[model samples]
Target: MPADRPYDRRRLLRDAAVGAAAVSTAGLATGVPARAAAPAPAGAPITAARARRSGAVSFRWWGTAGWRIDIGDRTVLVDPYLSRYDTGLFTGRFNPDTPLTVDAARIDPLVDRAENILVTHTHWDHFNDVPHIAVRTGARVVGTLTAYHLGLAYGLPAGRLAPVKGGEVLDFGDYTVEVVSSLHSRNGSWSLAFPGVRVSPPPRPEKISDLPEGDTLAYQIRVAGGPSVFFTGASDLNERNLTGLTPDVAMVASAATTSTADYVPRLMAALDHPKIVVPVHWDNFETPLTNPPTVAASDRERLDDLIAAVRKASPRSRVLLPEYHTAYHF
Candidate 1:
């Protein structure tokens, strides 16, 4: 493996325990420590005035596949995992036993209000902070039946969970969320990390791997008089499922490799070549949620490739690279 590309998934999975321990210790010494339990850095929160600013709906990237979408006083969070806990995934020593955690100090300031939480999948990076957020803000958790069961297992109130198996058009007064069945991004061998689903509530999740992929789903959120935005936590998708969505903005996740054939072109064409394409899920999730987000060497390269592909496939579509905690209006 090259020194620059620290996070080779196949290599990380193949590494022996002894070698992984050594690398993990070395990584902790050299890499940025996980700050989910530490005090949030200054200037991390979106202010009240800016969050609820009059005219347009506000969207802020929270790293990974996380996003905070504020539609007036009501807020909708999509995969809002702010913990960013170090699981050794990006340190060349992936540990499936990393305990789940949440830092209210880090998440509270930014997500003061929310009406709903849209989950794409139950992966740790996407769902670890979800249960806590759902309980904290009293927001309805919407996702697969697996997500509902998992939320129940996590002690979330039963009434707070809304399970869907895709193709559900839910009206939330000012806005609507149309659920679409989707596929998770594949690894080198076209496999997922922890693939499975919880048909019923199981034991309380204690570690990272406990949260399975739990099936993948995408969401298209459209504000009554505003723009319609599409969000997917993973890179791969079923083109047929996106037929007539034609969202104004699409939050496309960057893939680890070109495993999905013509990913950009297919997605662009599927969504009628969205007007604005925002690349997401490209940042390193093991680090702190700070400004100038941390992008591993491999992720940076993939992001560049994704951006170029978008430009080539959808020349007219505007691509916006989001900065953490910064507010963006369509």
Candidate 2:
């Protein structure tokens, strides 16, 4: 294998373990208090005073497929997987069948202010940290029935868990969130790295890998009188579901190795081409959070391809490459 291939499982697991331990210890030593403000219901109007108090919608990327969106007095999270796991030690080997090994201390700071959590699927990286975040922040957890069961197993209060099978439009006071049915990327060299799997409900499994991809979803979040944003955690898209949906900003996953070769253009066309596109999930996940993001030799090419595709398909769309932990106001 090339030295900079970036998917060396053994090396990734080893480093992740060490990094997780350090983060856990540090987080325990200096944990931030969870915010007490509750999230407003969808469709709630954003008054001028409230808008001035909260300013414009701000988005912060938390590595992997996690995003923190703050609008008015409400904060919503999408596919937050801040608990870096040491997947190299799983018994299932390449499969994601492993017990949840979340670094709670590490995740506390990122989720302290969140009032709502939206999960795209039940994959380890997209859903692992959600239970902890919900419990800590008193945020509503929204997703498939599988995700709700996982939350229940993780001890989340029933009231905080909202189960859905897509096609739900929620009113959160200052913003409206629409849940659209979506599809996970195919399992192949240029798609999701693991086999596409789903877990049965009623009794949540003890292992993380057992947590299946119940149902994939994409979120079209429209802030009252503010920018509308669309989020897709996986590379695949259901064109019919997204047709006629035009968002001002689109956060598209850019992991080339785990995506179809032409995902970018297809996604762009499906959403009617947004004005701004942000490439996310392009960073190597196995690496530690404290370390700077590393673009694998192969990923660099994939990113270039994505950019070219975006330009060709949507010439007017501005592609923004976000830095980790940095907030982008829209």
Candidate 3:
């Protein structure tokens, strides 16, 4: 909390309560704001956007484990993978030669004015195509050491890349970011199922390491006007491990065997019980992924269940699981 922080617990409770109501309205009609917020601020405002959120705060899910968190003047993308996931873009085959083929055209507008891109790990889906965006926009690439170099391979200057170790923090124009520890897994496919339905994931590269992605990381961004947002790259939440942090919003992963309602319940019960939540790492592939299994409609249904569970687990928490490119203001 390096920033001279403002923690108005009452405002947070009110926003979460009100935001949930608005999101429910918007969710039902796809346009309703349970309640309207103030007008939006122009891009790159000299001073930080206020906590009042005069404009909107939204989460746009772009298949795979990606999200564009739009908070008025500044837009932030987290572990984005907008392309068809199975297109070898994730394997080393695509990166070393093909240049992570994303639906860049779709990505362009989402990141139209993004000042920072948070890379959760060096995994292909999270970090690969980002450098392409960074080089084109000169946006800062924030992640681990390997991610920093991988960015260089994609033609971005080292200066534009900011390497962050776990448990560290960085400063954005009007916000602060805290890096969370990530428990990364190898890329091999494993057995998975949903409601007794079974499928296998695609063939994955031989694991390069086994320490749960030494460089895998999560982030907590404390912005001026909004609540504190926490992002989980890909992890199995351990209350013992994350007990130290208090996050108002969490972006957790639910793919493969991890899509079960059980997997998320325990995790949510242990955390600070965020006011808002978003699910990632599900339904992000070109076709049926070839080991265990990948994101599918069952997974989506499971996601539906996860949302329901979140509501039950934290009655006050507002759940936001948006479709690709959809916008929300909270």
Candidate 4:
């Protein structure tokens, strides 16, 4: 069980932090807190188009909380950040002024078919490539009001962005999406980086810090007569909002530190112990999305802890650590 409600942000931050020698940099500038990239074993690439006709849903991880979910002929993307440009995040020298970039050459191939793009927050890693992808694919960008404002600031057409404040069950013929109000993962200080919301359109974001947290959210994509998948862009979640979700697959994020109360265990129970738990946002985001995904030396232990906790909490659930671009069918 988790600690009592009404947490003490400052106290937790102080207790969770190690001395300067072993400082935990979780939820640092990149909002991933303290993740490092190390290589992961390669997974077999299984593309099953024919399986789609039988109500099979295909899922592909785009690294750092991004996913490509295919339901029949339509495609839905969640926090799809494929640019993976260098930001000095994992290099021990964090740079807040890193310029925002778009790698069309890389993103073009993966995102050209998306019909709907879900934004979990306005953080740079999650939202940087959204505008470009939405414009190119003409997909509807659904997220918070701040995400909508950021989309407009990025020159995305008003009609192309849909502002949702959770509790919206949108039917898209072959599937439906349920938006849940959520929270961003806290840093070692029990605070978030670049925290703030833009109620209205703000200046165009040029550098990474220019884009604020703008709040966070989680998404549940339910395929018609098939499987339901839950995606979280940040490690922390709103337990109250997750009740009764009971997804077939849950793409849970790994915590950078132990700030949240029993992060993994509480989530597994709240979601009714999903049949499959796919851990996301665990790899090194600064590195390119290639075979053998990278994890930092320190992050290796954190990733193991997350997996172990999931297994203990839900012994029957299968925990799948995703490899970049590898297809998974449920």
Residues 69-93, candidate 3, lDDT per residue (tens digit)? 6666666778765544343322212
State the lDDT of candidate 4 residue by residue for 59-172, as single tens digits: 878988898876655678998998988766654455678899999998997675778999999888899999999989899999999999999999999998899988899988
**Between candidates 3 and 4, which one is better according to lDDT?**
4
For model 2, the local distance difference test gives 0.67
TM per prediction: 0.85, 0.79, 0.68, 0.84
Q: Best candidate per TM-score, number? A: 1
Candidate 2 Cα misplacement greater than 4 A, ranges: 1-54, 89-98, 189-204, 255-261
Compared with the true structure, all predictions reach lDDT values of 0.76, 0.67, 0.54, 0.75
Predictions ranked by lDDT, top down? Answer: 1, 4, 2, 3
Candidate 1: residue 120 lDDT (0-100):
96
Model 1: residues >4 Å from true position, as ranges?
2-53
* Every model: Cα RMSD to truth: 8.6, 8.4, 12.5, 8.6
1-330: candidate 1 lDDT, tens digit per residue: 553343456322211111111112122121221112211223334433443344336788898789987765677899998978878776667778889888788788777767799999998888988888887799999999899999999899889999998899999777889999998887666566788999999999999889999999999998777778999898788999999999998999887655678888999999998888877886766778886566655344565677788888998887776667766776
Q: Which residue pairs in candidate 1 collide? A: none
